[model samples]
Target: MFKKKYLALVLLPLLLLLLAISFLGQAGATTSSKSSAPLAAGVQDIVDRGVLRVGVKQDLPNFGYRDPENMQYTGMEIEIAKKVAAELGVKIEFTPVTAQTRGALLDNGQLDMVIATFTITDERKELYNFTTPYYTDAVGFLVRKDSKIASNWEALDGMTIGVTQGSIQWGLLEEIAAEKGIHFNFRELGSNSEVVVALAARRVDAFSIDQSILSAFLGKSNQLLDIQYKPSEYGIVTKKSNTELANYLDQLVQNWNKDGSLQTIYNKFGLTPVTEISD
Candidate 1:
């Protein structure tokens, strides 16, 4: 009887200890499950991948240009991209893009975002998500100094103008032509450098694009027309379904604007952003 009582006492404590350990193990598993809940799809995917793929212009100087000799990218947009990667704690991979290819790449899931001087428009907003404008600029024309083209929109009537393919400048100019009752012949080229070459070869009378972009091509042989028009706002672009990513980007832009970070970037590149233009 004493032996039976002693065994019962020992077995009772052992059973209690095992029950406590089982309860604690289940509790720990529950806590971990709650803490490991997945993030939103857009944010989670990027975090899981460990890299941020970005599309950037390879031609535009002081914005997203790549050096031919060293193959290094240095520009205001590049710096902004680096900031984004840093914020996400990921490495950045830049894919060369142009006005024509940026949207297509985003649509095909080849790029996580595009910072290639993408102009935001109502039509574009229907297709992809856009952050608030980080930079604003106006359209301008670059003409040969010796071409004797008057520095006004009216003077370009019936003359051939070179514009980048898929740029908004064509539609903007169309509207201006309709308003002024004048017409312009437009040559849509694949890239900015091609348009510049067309202008140099006199294949087109003028090369037109954002004033800041035109400034890069300006030289002793060419001059920017004295006229600027239709202020364009550039925004960071992401896939339409990535609303979470877009919101995050929008908040970053808003914070940067408020804190003068955007202006600091502009100053670093010697850029003076134009919000409005006087005719």
Candidate 2:
């Protein structure tokens, strides 16, 4: 009987050891499988670093403009950046960039993404990956409320026009003017504020940019021409090779649409022409 008792005790420990070994083997397999699976490098990079660096505009109010009063970034795009960082479970560091530098910022890994009213285009796609667009921004002209070139091309044939460098309408405005035999001096500036300042100082008669930006200057300037010359879809821009991050952002946009969160964000800012994203 004493022998039986000793044997039982020994066997119980052996059985427990075997069970533990089996469980550990299964756990090891799971760990191995997960380790071997493809890692979302872009997302993982943000997670590992605990920060999501984003490129954004410094001017262009209502979209990505900064508050001069508090000197803090707070606009529709800024809010969107905040939401994206919150969703990614990380902190966001906003780097101010102009149209010319935004793509380059993302290309050199300086920014995880660009939410600076980046328009998705075929030419741009080869250089960057764009998530499903969150909104559509059209081309528009902003002339001073008292300017003579309010709407039409006539009566301002030789005036200077201001456009942001690297903006879709930058060269196109001049190109169209040349083609139409409406000669005008074209000034491509570094930022939207520069363009607006040029117009204010009479350095440029008209300022052309995205309509959403033109909306911000509503009371000060007349959006005389809301031409959808190039229907620009505002998309989140990422590195060309970072499709995984792009996909995640696409999914995030879809979910935002489904949950009405996107509309809420638009409503909070009292913005019109709120964009609806598709899956």
Runs of candidate 2 exceeding 4 Å displacement? 1-39, 69-71, 154-158, 174-183, 220-223, 226-228, 274-279
Best by TM-score: 1
Q: Provide the clash count, candidate 2.
A: 0
Model 1: CA > 4 A from native: 1-39
The whole-model lDDT of each prediction reads: 0.90, 0.79
How well is each residue in 34-119 modelled by candidate 1, as lDDT tens digits?
99766577877897899999999887889999999999998999999898888888999999998888999999999999998888
Instruction: List, residue by residue over 1-279, the lDDT tens digit for candidate 2.
Output: 999999999999999999999999999999999986554887888888999999988877767777779878977788888998898789989899887888788888899999988888889888898888777767767888777554556555787778877877856667767776888778888877787878888888888777788777767455456344556788888898899999988888888878988778878777766343221
Indicate the residue-level lDDT of 61 in model 2: 70
Worst 10 residues of 1 by lDDT: 36-45
lDDT, residue 255, model 1: 95
Candidate 1 residue 118 C-alpha distance from true site, Å? 0.5
